[model samples]
Target: MGSLLFLAFAYLAVGQAAVNRNGAQTAADAAALAAAQDKRDQLAGKWVEEVLDPTQWQDIFDGFAPGLTPSCWRADQLASQNDAHVDGCVPGPLEFEVSVEMDNPVGDSIIPGTEGRYSTESAIAVIEPRCTFELPEEDAGDDVLPQLTCKDRNWDLDPEDLGDLPAPEDLFDVHLAD
Candidate 1:
């Protein structure tokens, strides 16, 4: 009976550790995705500002929008929401990498060292442009802008009337990196 009880407690401790590890991974994934989505929104907004200039569209699609702010704050916020804290957040051209640690360690585990140890995990998220456009031929009028096709949907942009613009999700896709 003593041996069986000890074994049960050991299994419980392992399960607790596994749960903490999974939670940490979830937090990291959320943080990375939030950071990438924020950057994607910024790029889409920049594109809307430079709607008439087809030359700048390519650069924006490639995640080269100038004067944009860092997106790490968004990652921190997301991590906090998941009961974790972001240890590191790195922003790439169109990707975000985030590492998160759980706020609480596995408590009172049978494993001696597990009681005070917290789980940490890292995740990466990528932003991919979903829209494509072809510049107008030479001698084309300045008022005529090229039509943008995004995810099989046609977006005919009129410089004079700028109301019906694509949302951030339509311009870029945010997903966890494989």
Candidate 2:
């Protein structure tokens, strides 16, 4: 009976450790995914209005750079896109880049340089996703596989991604001297 008690306590301690670790992982994944998508949305909105220059890239890191959001995961300041400028400043002028990756559905849209600013294709991929709980089907028989249901509550984009513009800029040239 004493041995059984010891075994029980050991089991409980190990289970607690495993659970704590998994919780940490979930938080980290959530934060990473959120930061990537959030950054993308911000860029998409600013793309049409202002060019993503060196300064602009710096702005991307802003206050969101460090630690995890309310959702967890680690966020850090990404360097400017110009590979030539390792110091975040380029001599031949600076440009933005797709440093962050996500499960983008709109595809890679690279904004071009027209008046010191250019466009970049947005990439959407499920960088981080929410938790999905699955249950086993009870109708499985011998040599039969049980069907599992998958629920996707993860992934997101900024409101700017859905912004309404007069028209697609690529379709025509409308220059403003602001």
Candidate 3:
């Protein structure tokens, strides 16, 4: 009977550790995605600002827009929301890598040294530009812009109208890197 009880406790301890590890990974994934999404939003905004200038569209889609801000703060906020803390946030060309540690350690368990153990995990999220536009063959004037095709959806953008602009999600896709 004592042996069975010990085995049960051992299983419980392993389950506890697994849960904590999963939580850490979840937090890291959320943090990385948040950072990438933030940058995607910023780029979309920049595109709107330069809508009339088709020459700048390629640069914007490539994630090299001017006046863009760092997105790591978003990672921190997301980690906190997930009951974790971001240990590192690194921004690359079009991706963000984040490492998170669980805010709470594994609770006291039958296994020794489990109470002080915290789980840390890392994830990478990428921002991929979804829109492609070909400059008009002829000068369409400042009031008109080229049609943009994003993820099979076409956007007929008009600088003068400015009401039906593509949203941030339409311009870029944010996903966890595998």
Candidate 4:
């Protein structure tokens, strides 16, 4: 009877740890995705700014403005929302790698050092741009038009098309790489 009871308790503890580890993984995934999404939004905003004034388009394309919201900030916010804390957030060119540690630990178990130890998980997300800007040729005419190519569709500076421009998600593809 004593051995059976101990075995049951041990299984329960292992199950709890598994649950905590899964939660930590979830937090890391969410944080990474959020940061990547933020970067994608920044790219879309730059596209809009260039659209407003084609003259500044080259500069914007060559060297874009800094993001209004830092990727680390977005990751931290997401981790907290998931009952975890951001252990690390590193932004690479259109990608964010995040490591999160669970705030709630698995219950004490027979395994030594299991108490008060949090599970940590890491995830990576990448953003792929769906649009490319090709500068229009210099013209003598007053009207200067730039080419906006996205998703195999050429878009001019038409007000209706501009208004119907693809959403940020459409302009960028964000997904978990690992």
Which candidate wins on lDDT?
Answer: 1
User: How well does candidate 4 score on lDDT at residue 116?
Assistant: 81
Please, what are the lDDT tens digits per residue for candidate 2 over residues 1-178? 9989877866665564454444433333333334444433433344334321222323322322222222111122221211111111111111111222221122121222222322222211132111122222445322332121123222121333434322222211211111
Go through the candidates in order and give the C-alpha RMSD of each one to the true structure: 1.0, 25.7, 1.6, 3.1
Q: Model 1, 60-133: lDDT tens per residue?
A: 99999898999999999999999999999989989999999999987787779887899999999999999999
Query: Which wins on lDDT, candidate 3 or candidate 4?
Result: 3
TM-score for model 2? 0.32
TM-score of every model versus the real structure: 0.96, 0.32, 0.93, 0.81
Model 4: which ten-residue window has the lowest total lDDT?
Answer: 59-68
Q: Measured by TM-score, how close is model 4 to the native structure?
A: 0.81
Stretches of model 2 off by over 4 angstroms after superposition? 50-178
Model 4 agreement with the true structure over 99-128: per-residue lDDT tens digits: 999988776888777898999999998887
Q: What is each predicted model's overall lDDT from 0 to 1?
A: 0.93, 0.28, 0.92, 0.79
Q: Which parts of model 3 are misplaced by more than 4 Å?
A: 138-144
